[model samples]
Target: MKMTRFLATGVSVALVLAIPNIVTAKPEVQGQVDFFGGDGVLRSAEFDARIDNSGAAEGRMIFIDPSAAAESDPDGPGEAVAGAQGLLIDADFDCLVVTNNRAVMSGVIVDSNTPERIGRRILVTVEDNGRGRRSPPRRLTWGIYPNQARNWTPTDGELGFDPGAGTSWLASDAEREDDVPVPSNRSEAVSCDSFPPGSHTLVDIGRDDGNIRVRP
Candidate 1:
């Protein structure tokens, strides 16, 4: 009876440790996205996540809104160019699916500068191409005019169009005028070869090499 008890205890402890490994054995993705200097308004995001089937994520997802520079006055003091409007969304991730070259993740916003954005959901996709320029550098790199172009680098210097992965997002649902439903019951440890079908908005490209990653 003592031997049986010892065996059961050992098995229980082993299972306990193994369960955590299983949970974390899934996919993990993290990266920064800057869609500014491109077309449209400045809509960028950053995230790091690895969630389970519960669909409730414990990570980070911050989105920035474009707020053209605080218009400057030729005769008045210069205005601050805080690129993005004060729009950052602290969120929890619940899903992370990876394809052969891309990783897709989703999360729900907990707080934000805008009240209507609270409780909304957003999804991001990162494409891994073995590290390279996301897009060729343009005059946007020199900060000259609104040419509707963007690059990974801010100048034509050595870092001009630095190497990094490409990241995109789908915020149509999250950008609604009002709060949206939270996400749940998403699968973990998935794989694919092509990006999921949809109109995803690229965040210009990663500003550096630590944009994002995915296994297989």
Candidate 2:
């Protein structure tokens, strides 16, 4: 009888130790960005991101805006807008994996000409109502904005900022007055398939050359 009791206690301890591993298993997701331009044509951009079970995320996104004169004037002087790449650091993802299917990432936009030139730090918030489910088709909404108080310029890196000033560039009147469509109306939604748990592969969708894909 004592031998059986000892064996039962050992099994209980083993089960207790294994429970944490199962409970701590991280939930991750991967997806890309596809949105319509001002001309109403769908444009695709590449983005891959993942969140650990602890709600920390590390990922990258490449933004490519199609040339406005591509179709109308093939030999025009204006070229397609250069691509901008952003790196995701230790951004918060708890809200996404927990209650709300929303995640916000903060990172810097690196310069295209010189890879080391950090142009500006920005915030990107994404929300998916379908939670990556396939049947309903996951709908993703994205918003982008500057996170710093300084203004961005092509020549001068980042300029005009007062540390002690109470003004915020994100909420400044100048930003609101700007008529640029990309920054002003940054929010857009696109349908995508669900990403299953433990899956770590790239999924591509949309047009041929301007396609978007998410990679592990």
Flag regions of model 2 displaced more than 4 Å.
22-29, 33-38, 46-57, 67-99, 111-118, 129-135, 147-216
Model 2 — which ten-residue stretch has the worst lDDT?
189-198
lDDT (C-alpha, whole model) for all candidates: 0.51, 0.41
Residue lDDT tens for model 1, 114-202: 54455555555666555545643211111111112233333345564744333333343656767644333222322121235233443
**lDDT tens per residue, model 2, 1-216:** 999999999999999999998777653445566765345655554555565655566556555444322222235556533433322322222222222444444445554332322444434444443423342233333333333353432332353664434432333355566653333322222111112222222222223223222222
User: What is the Cα-based lDDT of residue 93 in candidate 2?
Assistant: 23
Candidate 1 — which pairs collide?
A: 57-93, 99-192, 100-192
Which structure among the candidates has the greatest TM-score?
1
TM-score of 1: 0.45
Clashes of each: 3, 0
Per-prediction CA RMSD (Å): 18.6, 12.8
Q: Model 1, clash count?
A: 3
TM-score per candidate, in order?
0.45, 0.41
